[model samples]
Target chain A: MTDLLPSPPPATRRPAPPGALSIGWARVALELRLFVRDPGQLVFSFAYPVVMLVIFGSIFADREVAPGVDFRQYFLAGIAATGIMLTSFQAVGLAITEERDRGDLVRLQTLGTPPLAYGIGKAGQVVLTTAVQLTVLLVVAATVYDVPMPDDAGRWLTFAWVAVLGVLAGTVLGIAVSSFVGSARAAGTGIPAVAIVLQFFSGVFFVFSELPGWMQQLAAVFPLKWMTQGMRSVFLPDAAKAAEPAGSWEHGTTAAVLAAWVIIGVVVCARSFRWRRNAG
Target chain B: MTTTHGAPALPAAASGERPAVQVRGLVKRYGGRAVVDGVDLDVRRGEVFALLGPNGAGKTTTVEILAGLRRRDGGSLEVLGEDPAGADRRWRDRVGVVGQSTGAGDALTVRETVDHYARYHATPQDSAELLDAVGLEGTARTRVDRLSGGQRRRLEVALGVQGRPELLFLDEPTTGLDPAARRQFWTLIEGLRDRGTTVLLTTHYLDEAAHLADRVGVIAGGRLVEVAAPGALGAGLRQEATVRWTEDGAAREVVTREPSAVLRDLLAAAPTGEIPDLSVTRPGLEDVYLRLVSEGASR
Candidate 1:
């Protein structure tokens, strides 16, 4: 049947796909470049948390959860956790919604972009930007608020895993929610509202021990609570552990919850992501 | 219902020619109403085929199904030797699509956007050459959001062809362009055709189809009313000429199969050698197209 037509030229023969890894890196580079070009997004993702930390850190400077464990240090940890979520969840959610609305995702799909590569590209942007945001937050906390860095290698290691897992979980969840959003405008307000409410529930803006027992239980079911606790474990003094709701840093639970979210978010994102708005 | 004489019979797959695209009984439904009722079409390799229709006429829907961007309720279809429903990345690599409403990433500059799309195909066209061909070289450094609508469209075309696909789908590609830019865009499509790319373009403009398509399909009311060479469409109607003349202080007109005979009779009746305000003209493609569309709608 194929022989009925004259043979097309050699170049017309189907070409093998450009390798997935290469495509993924290309997407990552492009996403990063775009992220940098949008000054509004840059300032919101990187600067908002730093600004919040300074304003709140100063208000609670002298209060201590325990002797030698300043309340400002505890607030610093929560602000850093929130910064990771801002960069990963909020940034990714808003970008995906806008892309879908603008038909950009449909354009990419038509070009035969590997779906995995596209996901990797978004996640890569989240990771890189979250890293930068985290660095700025940490630097500000240390220099301005006089919050000390994690002195031990183990504490630093904890910080690394928590941040990585928090970002991954947030990135995938962001993508998953992006599909359900009706438009970029909806996502702009909706995603941040969800983030802020989670912050309140997860004790980012309040002391976990002081929150109502039901709110603490409710917060335990979500990842942000674990992420905040994990951040506190790394940055706060060892004596501050007594002030935790569990009376100690629940490192094991934090790891399990964040990792589980990463897995669950990936599944949800894969199922929910759409190339076009209002697509069947 | 008004299939033209030049329309091909549904040939077997092993027949004389392997068409780049073939559809039979294509159907798409929205809330139980068939937006694309039943569409049958064929586009041979290395030829430019245009689908002409009015708004809500299913042109975009049909093209979307062909491009694998939308699903059909029922149909037997083939594009680039594969069913778009089951088409994979390999099939996609060979088929380029410039969707009617879909657009590229707006945050990236024109060159970067082109470069990004090029990475999806194994062998892509040179970015500089593509930009120049689409008349976007001067604006390559400008962010896509900053581009004028026509420039953005030119950029869309640049991305669509960057992959050098065997088949290209352009949906209303010249909708917003100035006449000069539209002509330039037509030239670029001609160049692609010269390189053996089979193009399936959809447009409401008769002149665009008449100028570029080797064959034009007139679709209306979710059905293909006719498929013929631009000049040959509604040929039977075009054969009859309309003759008009002034007589007895009134304008008189007659529709006839032979304008010469009518002119002869009118001249003989006139006392003067010259008939007053006389004209004999046949229907152009535009008239035929409008007639076809209106007829298709009524049916």
Candidate 2:
């Protein structure tokens, strides 16, 4: 049969694929560009944290936690934690759900995009945006509210490790949550609401040691509480450690909990991430 | 002709015989009902094969299975010489799919979207050249969300072929296009055909099947009724021409194999050499397709 028909002109040999890393990097660039283009997402992800910081910082301008640390300075660390969650977990969940609903993920799947590469692209975008978001929050704190930057190298290092782990845990959890959501609209409302409620429980709006015993125990189980605790350790002085529930920063527990969540979130993401909302 | 389950196997010339796609007893069911029931088909490489069927006749389901987008409940199938269900990135790189609806995201510009997807393939057509090929060069800078429906579909085609796939599956590519856009789309597909891309398209429109397909497979009731060249469909029906003429102010019609012989008798009986309103017409593919579909419906 086919032999009887004139054969097609020989296909030219194609170059080997640039490999998954390059494709993943390309996706990162594209995702970032799109993120910048959507003003709604931009304001929500970047501005929400900055605005919260300013509002809380202004309200407590005259109040002081100790000899030098103002209440606004203490609140700034919690706001930064919230910012990380906003950009990584909440924003990522919403983006994935909407993209899945829109069929973009399915299109990429058909295009031979490795799921790892897609995840990399998504994680990269969150990392970049979250960095910018935290910078803006810090700038507002340092310049406007007379809040000092971390003076020592150790504090800066703690900030770096905590930020990386928080973002990683949040991003993976976001993707995993997207797989469970049935529609973009549901994710849109549900993810942000979940983020806000977690903040209340995790002591973002109040000092952690002052919260009720049951609330403290429940908050300790979640990543956001660990993230807020980690951020506070970086911003506050050694004397402030006495105000923690354990009378110390509990750096080991913070690191262990965040790392555990990262592991759990990765496992959940690998098992649950879907290319389409209705995927079987 | 209405149903061909477990159809006769193609003769073995096992060596050097590779169809672009081959399926045996393909079956896909939802709950208790089979949407695609025991379909067997072969699409030769580099030919445009159209699976023509009415809405919900399983054309899309069959095409989706062959494209590896959907799973089959039971079957043995090969696409581009690989089992699609287990096909890897390498296999996907050789296949392109233009789905029934547009899946291109609106956030990126037309050129960016094309270039973005092009990165997925080892060898991709140039984004600028592909846009030009699809007659969308002018709209390259336009945001995808802003493009008109027809333009959006053309961009979808550009994205589909940017991978330079050897086998392309188009599921009802022109379902909603206006006449002019549909013709323009046909020309684009024709260009791809000239480039030797093996195309498998599913369409409910008979004229589209006739215009674009080298061979059309009329499928109904989740089964292929017949697979033949458009002109060769419904062999028995094609032989019988419907002859009509006005006699004594009454219209008379007869179905016959030889329209010329019937005309000769009419000519001899008429005192005047003119046969009023005489018309001899064989059933077109559309008629044959409708008749075949009706038979499938009844069964």
Candidate 3:
């Protein structure tokens, strides 16, 4: 007796092709499209900051906290700084933690996406979202809130530079914080907790001089203090600077400190970041 | 023929054939003990090679190293003729991997997921054709989170092949699939192999290995114990055939090295024209697999 079975087809051999795109723009487009599909994330990213700006603007309306510097002008720069922090630190950090928990990072690793590509994609998303947030806040400030806009090219350029710096600082800090937080829930709370505390001491809501000496020293260590201070330099006059403890705007020092923070934040994020939850 | 230790030596792929993958003296350690110990392997182009192992047998670690996701402590490894340790993006585009972790974005529709990956490769397969190939045409508009496990797995396979990769790594590609889904997945894999795709698969299911693999290698206790064609893995155990017959109003059993000889003897003893309820059985892949694993454990 004999038994016969169908034979497998003969193997066909071919050479493999080369890989492409070390840090491709297409990945950024993909991330942005996915982000927009989440209604909750979209609302929180774009609308939350604008709503806070409105509520705070109305509460401080018609008040002159410093001579020749009204509450509206003072709060405009502070609100913009806060918006950068919210979008870059809280938003990016929580999203990364959620993706890590969901095994998205592990999946991306298998696709041979270079690690630098992931960072570039994330930074692009943060910059784009922050630009929208800044535009909405500035429009409301200028048209509805009766805040003055910068007339000179120098001041407008300064405002643009400060916003860019704020974004870089916030993104680096957010990625660093994300490396330490293990779970999405912890990240959600921890990000907001750190942001709220920094806001208080950085003089976003109150005068920084009123805080205790040790508290003032602690706040100076954070990038938010220098970020808001630099933003205020673009919007406020020299005489108004008298109210600040440093008298004239410390523009040079603020730029230096913020740049240093950006460097430190990047180093921390690189050292501590893990592609997977259980990765060694 | 030149023999090594009185065993028929298998010929390695010839020089200039360009193995799809090669790993020599590979080792990985955890908690001061090696999980993968000095394993050597070569997979020829377009061959369906299966790695069979029990749970916690370091199969995952080995595959991860080949996929360039993990670093090996000691090994000379080459994937697609380049060292995976330092291969560039051009080298990566040649390989595809479907791991246990799913890469699909939960919010994106199935079509979007396939389309998004299509942009990453220079010569990607058409999105419509990829969806049809994976049997996901109906679910193209469905979000990944809403799809069933089988659908998600199919989506993963679609993404894995969209790059037109020459080498594909599938890690337990059929786990969690129902029998019908498993059969369907096998067809897709067979199609891929037919298209000249080299597949390196790891599966716990013996039937899956027996049905798809041209050659299977079994690993136990951090070591590769044996490698053979599925039918030849335990040929010694299959030497005896078991014949069962109904005789004298009772079931009778006999084991013999030669089934034809035994059948002739039984026919002569019964004196009956017809043998009642006659059945011939041989040892299967599962039986050989279980015996190999048990022996490995005992040693």
Candidate 4:
């Protein structure tokens, strides 16, 4: 029997002209647009930290047992440091794993977009989102909650360096963790679980001196502790140093530890990162 | 469509002229066993080359290597006169690909998806014109996740050709398309060929190969078993014709190499001048394909 449908007319459209932007810029723009359109991502990256800051700051505002420091100022610095970790680690890790699970990464490889472009776009998004989060947190801390600002230009510079170091460490660590996770769901849970434990022991929730000796040492090995301590040194008064064993800010040591973590994190990320989830 | 009735035939690849794509003694191994054996292929410029094989025959692996997405274990390969193993940005810009699966971002609309890919090439097609050419104008604002399978496939084709590539790879481009959609896609592909774009397509649908390809290659067990025109594959297979008719109110059929001879016989048998419901049928490309694949499987 003859088929009833009419045959389609031959196509007449012209081919795309040669000469366009490089694929790298196209990839970055696509990634940025997608990330911004996802409302859940925006809230988690920019709002969650502020919510935590307010709740934790209010709860610890009146607890005056620690010597030479007000609890609110100390936690504010710790919360800001934790916010950077959240953006870098949880944000980057889960996003990468989700994209992999969805087969987006594999699609990109076949399209001839280099793997490095994908990673760079992801890192750019994390850094931009973290910067916005930091700005929001600082505004709330300074204007609404009466959290003290850095006392001098030098202290402010130190705070800036600490934030940068914290974000770098977090981004590297997140990429590494994403490479290890089996699925997007696992990444979601695994990243936050590690972040919460680190926050508790890194003195974001309590003074590090109150922790057991081994717990203090264990926390010291992590980058979060150094980030928190460095931020506290910038915002907290000198009298607050009395609670610690040294009774003074060890800015050099904190800087060195964070720098070392950054190096190790970068190595792990580069060595372990996979472009496709199925890549062994 | 304006047919070129007297256009000159394209030149064949000479001994020293560079083939659009060349692969020699290519091999891909996993766990000590080669998935793609020592297969060799040559695709000349301005040719519609179809690579046909059954599932798990390593067609995808071969395409991936040609696309510069995977490394070959042992081979000398060249695409566009440069080694695909070390193809740089310039070489990449010359190639376009539509993989077996739909690879566009599902969250983006059709227009946005086309626009985004356009930026990847030094020169890209206009988004609206590309969409119209691909029959996607009505769904430009619709999200990819919401499009039907056929629409999504069209979008995939649009993205593949957005760069106006010198060479294009289509992996199972019409796998899930309805007959109408499939025919529409073929028209778009023909347009690409008209513009001097070389196309390399892989499909299980033999009709697709027969209709669109200038030459077809059968790949079996990771090897190039045979390559010829779609009608010329499987020697002696298409030589026979099956003639069917009604004799004395009952159906009758006969197979013979010469249908004209059979038609003469049918006219002699019938008392009247006209034969009853006569039809002459030849073996199709699908028959040759199945026979070849089954024979390869047994071996």
Give the CAPRI class of candidate 2.
Answer: acceptable
Candidate 4 interface RMS = 8.3
Candidates' RMSD to native? 4.9, 4.8, 6.4, 7.8
Mark the regions of model 2 whose C-alpha exceeds 4 Å error after superposition: A1-15, A64-69, B1-16, B240-282
* Candidate that scores best on TM-score: 1
Q: After superposition, how far is residue B201 of candidate 4 from its true place, in Å?
A: 1.2
Question: Which model scores highest in DockQ?
Answer: 1
lDDT of 4 by residue, B1-299 (tens): 11112322223357765678877777888777777888778888888999999888878888988887777787667787777777676677678888877456777888998887766655677788888878888999999899999998888877787777778899999997899989988888888887778899998778898899988888877887778988788867778789999878999899899999988877777768667789999877677788777776555
lDDT of 2: 0.84
Instruction: Report the TM-score of chain B alone for all candidates.
Output: 0.89, 0.87, 0.81, 0.80
What is the C-alpha lDDT profile of model 1 across B140-197, one tens digit per residue? 8998889988888888777787777889999999997899889877887887887788
Worst 10 residues of 2 chain A by lDDT: A1-10
Ranking by TM-score: 1, 2, 3, 4
Candidate 3 similarity to native, TM-score: 0.85
Better of 3 and 4 by DockQ: 3
**What's the lDDT for candidate 4?**
0.78
Give the Cα error of residue A223 in candidate 2, in Å.
0.7
- Give the share of true interchain contacts found in each model: 0.47, 0.38, 0.28, 0.22
Please identify which of the two predictions, 3 or 4, would achieve the higher TM-score against the true structure: 3
lDDT of 4 by residue, A17-77 (tens): 2332345556667877887878888888788878987897778777754554667777888
Question: DockQ of every model listed?
Answer: 0.35, 0.29, 0.23, 0.22
Instruction: Sort by lDDT, best first.
Output: 1, 2, 3, 4
Worst 10-residue lDDT window, candidate 4 chain B: B1-10
